[model samples]
Target chain A: MDHFILMDAGLGNFVVFVVGPIFVGFVIGALYLIIKSIVVIRRELKNEKASDNENNEQIK
Target chain B: MEILIYLIEGCIGAGMLFIAVKFTILIESPIIISGGVTENKKYIASINSITNVIFNVVLVFISFYKWPVSSILWYIIAEFLLIPFSEILAYRAISKASVKQIIKITYCANLLSFVAGSLFVFILIALLGLF
Candidate 1:
């Protein structure tokens, strides 16, 4: 199976396309995760500030 | 033979795309975006690589569908034509650069890479034929 696929240029390219980009896609995916986490953290902080403001208002 | 040639061209084309994008980012940084991709270059490069891979795969499927043997040259005309637009859109999504800036950078980059890659392939083919 490996012999047949490895010997052919066409099959070999598919391997390059797939295997080569795994690292690239993985890195990009990690960047996306970091961006997402930052956005989520910002939203959470904003919501906490909003809740804290409401509590202060209630106490006043 | 045709399929083999096509596959070889595809591999070379993809490699050229990366080199072109990287170089274009450096060259255009001063004139276009003024360090737009500087800090996020790693991210952007990875994204561009992924986008390029997706397009190449699509081209392969399209080219291989109708025939058992195919030429990458004719299909490449269509591929290069579409690549810049997709690349522009991809770059625009990740950066704060203006549309005009993105378009110019992507266009120059794709053109440079396509010309270089195709020339290399043709030369290689010619060299092979000589022996």
Candidate 2:
């Protein structure tokens, strides 16, 4: 029983040490791209609206 | 020693935050400037290019920070996974497809990114048993 517990603990430690960072990096990098894209899209929308308004004013 | 580690981590955290913000600005600026003139596809492509460059820089920074053959290898692999994951999430959230879609996809994307970033640090600590 004691040996089994020790083996489990060691495995857990390895996962934490080796796999955790890679997972965290993957998630964070995903989030960064998502946020950056959103910002760009919003800016684009605002520009589109502004241009539409300018075009309307010219017509009037 | 703890203080030293924290300080170094803090600096790295700050640097990462700054780079993220810089990329956001770079992606946004062009759309704002050429709003009406440029097609949506073109604008998005430009933003994608800028984001890619920023991502590359970030990967390079992470590599240097972890320098010393043994430790750095895992970190670089982690970075590789991160770059694409973030990009796909952001792109999906941004490109709302139809013109009439009323949902604030951009805002959603940003919020998701912020949460993910914070959670990532915690996950890293847990994984590395650094804390």
Candidate 3:
């Protein structure tokens, strides 16, 4: 079973093979989430403010 | 054959994260006025982290069908690193920075880290003569 996975894998191989991908995955994933969260927040705030103004005018 | 499999697994997992983030941003674009900007960013960041953990767990399951305990353990450890990264970016985004500037900075950061990780992996593979 070990031979099937890697002809000769050690701690180093496991580090690069298993941990490496997860590291890269998180890097991109976090960025995507960050930008996304920002965009969503800004857009939502803008819309909410706009609606609030409309409601105020309606109340008047 | 095994090397290619690992490479593909990494790519798929990364791609899945990208798409999941995009989908989340799109679906939650409208604000419900529950809190201030900073508060909202924190909520969104927390949500993203949750989804990311679940996503990574599923990816690990699919990638390693026979799930060696060591491999799964290492993967989980790596996934935890995302929490800090996400929080840092969230703080930056909610700071006084403009959207364009924040996006550019985060994009460069992500690209640089990805390239660095890939290069390190390749160097290790070359050194070990695994490929």
Among these predictions, the greatest lDDT belongs to: 1
Of the candidates shown, which would achieve the greatest TM-score relative to the real structure?
1
**What lDDT tens digits, residue by residue, belong to model 3 across residues B17-130?**
665555443333232112122335445544454544454555555566655675555545543455335534664644445555544444443444334544765787798996
Chain A only, candidate 3, TM-score: 0.75
Residue B106 accuracy (lDDT) in model 2: 36
Model 2, stretches more than 4 Å misplaced? Answer: B1-38, B42-131
Displacement of the residue A55 alpha carbon in candidate 3, Å: 0.8
Clashing residue pairs in candidate 2 (N, C-alpha, C atoms within 3 angstroms): A29-B86, A30-B85, A30-B86, A34-B90
| Residue B128 miss distance in model 1 (angstroms) | 2.0
Number of residue pairs clashing in candidate 3, backbone atoms closer than 3 angstroms, sequence gap of 3 or more or interchain = 0
Candidate 2: tens digits of C-alpha lDDT, residues B1-131: 75565455545544554555555445444543343222366455445544544554455555656465633564344334543345445444444343222123333333444455548667877989964
lDDT of 2: 0.52
| TM-score per candidate | 0.45, 0.35, 0.36
Instruction: Please rank every candidate by lDDT, starting with the best.
Output: 1, 3, 2
Off by over 4 Å in 1: A1-60, B1-39, B65-81
Chain B superposition TM-score per model: 0.57, 0.29, 0.37
Candidates sorted on TM-score, descending: 1, 3, 2
Among all windows of 10 consecutive residues in model 3 chain B, the one with the lowest summed lDDT is B28-37
* Candidate 1 displacement at residue A53 in angstroms: 20
